[model samples]
Target: MGATQKMTIFKLCILAGAALVGTMSVAAQAMTPAQTMLGDAPSVPKNIVIMIGDGMGPAYTSAYRYYKDNPDTQEIEQTVFDRLLVGTSSTYPARVSGYVTDSAAAATALATGVKSYNGAISVDINKQTIPTIMEKAKALGLATGVAVTSQINHATPAAFLSHNESRSNYDALAKSYLTTDTDVMLGGGKKYFPVSLIEKFQAKGYQYLSDFNQLDSIKQGKVIGLFANVQLPWAIDDNDKNKLSKMTAKALELLSQHDKGFVLLIEGSLIDWAGHNNDIVTAMGEMEEFANAIEVVEQYIRNNDNTLMLVTADHNTGGLSIGANGEYSWNTSIIRGVQASPDFIANDALIHDDWLARVSLNLGFEPNEDEASQLARARMQGKEVMTTSIKHLIDSRSNTGWTTGGHTGVDVQVFATGPAASLFAGYQDNTDIANKLISLLPKAKSKSQSNK
Candidate 1:
């Protein structure tokens, strides 16, 4: 779609909420008639792949696009996915949940088609159980997979396979994985899976793989792999390069092996993490990496033709925004830094330990022994040297404002292609996501398999 055309549709969706002057400049660009018409509902795809960009909102997407399109100014364009769509509300009862929503509640709406209070997972406000798209797809004999950049048991992924009163019930939720016939379970949260439950998975004949190398060895059946104790690294980290996309590709490869089509939920969970930390560089880099995974899926869909790819976020984090007027050059540098950073950096602790030294080395401004000693003493006292530096760096970068380091109630953007893409058009409740997916799946012969 042309820039103008894309902005028009974006404005339409934005208008569904309160009008903000901030969105007007973007909306002035008209979308192509063909691109706008592409929103028309298409045939149901045989395979449904939902890519959840947890905590990414329109603001984040716009920032990424701005840097990507303006590559002449020294900013490296780093994006794998091209098309875009505006996302909708995950609010419950429409007006009851207010405009803001949390990940757990937003994910529940996306997964089960019902919005609940904040912190609830896969259940409605009344604490009632709801059928998820994955469960429905399974009953139709479709293969299923859930891949995330956070703990596999995190709220977004867990909403697809497990239900609980609180999203924090990692131990209880970890065990529920055993009952679901989900074909591929990838990402972090190794600690939540008690030793006994890990053994139980083994007993159930699941091929438990701990590393990416082991993924190649699995030829059949279900596979559960946890790459970290909690959340995985940001895509900008060199240490985690290719692991997230690798897991996504592997899951697609294995799940496609089944005679029946598959449904995969791939989450770029750390874009939200970076947002919470107000790390623009990290957030943009992770978004680019996640887009790479989308490209992989897009290629698969192109060949398969029967697969639908849906890209969206559960909620917005940090309410990220880009200034209309800024030194385009600095934005370019930041974008280049993001593109240069490999998929996944070293863990935060390792970065913390060596970051100062590395920055000093690269900038040719190392502190003297006395200054270093003072910094070490400050660190020993639990003070942050890097935090202070980052704040200064951010203040110098842009006039962008942030209300909180937490998730916002803003509507996220959703982009879809292939079959049933029209179902995503217009302003719809988050629960509509579940209903739309159910409509796309083949109807089951038994009532238990059908969504009421």
Candidate 2:
């Protein structure tokens, strides 16, 4: 075996040992009759929790672990994913499209089990409306909820609950939520809906809330929590609040109370944003928050064997690489010096000639004489060029490298447990994720419902 293979095996063994120490017996005992062995058949779980880390790839997960480790020995520390992963999946869009996929196309495929055009929400490749897993779950009398760190109408979460020809139709998508039976919707973007529509939502029995502190008042019923006008602030900037984990835990609590069970979608939406910024510290913070939320789901799964949990990503962003500067070693600790993302620092704060001073203060370093000259020229060129220059300097100083400022056509990892998770175990198309979950769902009255 290659050296890398040996390392992976070692890590797996360590994970197995840790699981044994944790609660192997609790997991086994909690398995319901449906989960019992039926020859080669698997269980159809009553509850399904889908967690999408918006721009995660192997590099992102690996870098997350590096940051999690003790930095002294570089020994691994097992996260929830280490125990649950079934396999990996190719993130390509439909055969009708290109190899690369944005979150909209990928999330559409994941929600409806249909190959779709980029930006196609829950609509099919031909722009026809298709029933999503959320809709199917609702039709079967199962509770449905969506909790994400992104705006509720964003590509990933919107695909589950709304149908639109273009994901950019945020206002339309927000209005369209009135047409679905999705019980709970949380996260940002209240601005997309006008007061009339918001009142209509409240009139329709959907509780509309935006204050993050008011989440506890929701016990059992329909709710629409739009916490931010846009996407929620980065986890680093908002470190005092574990909003993602709180949202996930709250969704699980609300959805699991139904007698017929539930299906909920949760997202760590801004990992992709961090990737787009090529901000490693911000990405790490997002991943850490995401993992904390995943812990809540796993804890729930330990007692609720009827639930299936799938953790995956739509696509990779930033084409992030850990080893920059031709170094054999990785210093995840270098990120401690970073205070904010270039996007925030450049646009959110006061801009002045002394801006580089704040950059130096946050990044722990200042540009050399020649690099300073380049920044001046870029600023003189325009805001766009200046933004690009700032992000480049930030990444460069930290030994991080990004191939693109946008998404990549990489195959993201899939982690699963409960029910037919084994189906996700090989290289499969993005649509297969939705297909496999649809197949594992509680038997629908009309058999054709599983197909779309």
**Global lDDT scores for all candidate models:** 0.72, 0.81
Give the winner by TM-score: 2
**What lDDT tens digits, residue by residue, belong to model 1 across residues 1-452?**
99999999999988865556545523532341113433342466778889988888878877777656765567645444336464354443334566678778888888877768888888877788888888888888999999998999999999899899899999899999899988899999988987788899988878887765787787778899987888876665556577778888889888988787889999999989878877677787788778788878877866776778888888889877675244343353444443322112211313466855654443234555665565455445442543434333443444455667887777666677666565675577677877788788886676665555
Estimate the TM-score for candidate 1.
0.79
Badly placed stretches (over 4 Å) of model 2 are 1-42, 347-360, 364-390, 445-452
lDDT of 1 at 203: 89
Root-mean-square deviation of Cα positions for candidate 1 versus the true structure, in angstroms: 8.8
lDDT of 2 by residue, 399-426 (tens): 7787888989989899877665555665
TM-score of each: 0.79, 0.83
